[model samples]
Target: MKKPAKIWLWVALVLCVCTTGLNLSEGRWLSVAIAIVSIIGLCVLLFGQRKAGYIVMCVCAVGSFVVGVTQNMGELGAALAIVMSLIGSALVPVITGLFIKSQWKELK
Candidate 1:
């Protein structure tokens, strides 16, 4: 995968690990759900080859929406989830930019 894709994959992996660990430690309801959703996001990021990844991403998005609404989270939480969805969707390009900057710096 491209650098951007790899970055997003790395972020998703980190989020999954962190969220899972938090859930295990604190037993927070949202923690478990976040971990599951992030894990799904990671799977889509890494192995979503044949349009399956897109479908998975869509599922994740909807899942985020449901979580936001069902929990009755205020605007902040809902906005956060929306932002997270956007990040998950465009993570590859964001990561790619970082790589490019780093590479340019190295060259300089």
Candidate 2:
């Protein structure tokens, strides 16, 4: 993968962690803002590969939705969020691998 793409992916991950941490602290608005920005950052990285981008976007979106539901919402929301986050987290590595492979393909 390109250096910039790797960097951006890490940044997204950091932001994801930050948002989740903030959520636990009840900083809902801040968490949401960070999540939104990270999602966009992920999009910028998407230019490298549409399929990778779409996968990452879906994962991040689902993760965000789960987080939103879990906090200060209700049991239903929490359950949904938990499920989505788990699924998203599981898919993240696969999408990242695809991104790296796509980058390598371009390099050839």
Q: Estimate the lDDT of model 1.
A: 0.54
Q: lDDT for each of the candidates?
A: 0.54, 0.56
Q: lDDT score, residue 57, model 2?
A: 60
- lDDT by residue (3-95, candidate 2, tens digit) is 766775776566566655766577566446646654564655554444455444655565565555565347446667666556544454445
Q: Which stretches of candidate 2 lie over 4 Å from their true place?
A: 27-57, 66-108
Among all candidates shown, the one with the greatest lDDT: 2
Q: What is the lDDT of residue 81 in candidate 1?
A: 59
For candidate 1, report its TM-score. 0.48
**How well does candidate 1 match the true structure, expressed as C-alpha RMSD?**
7.9
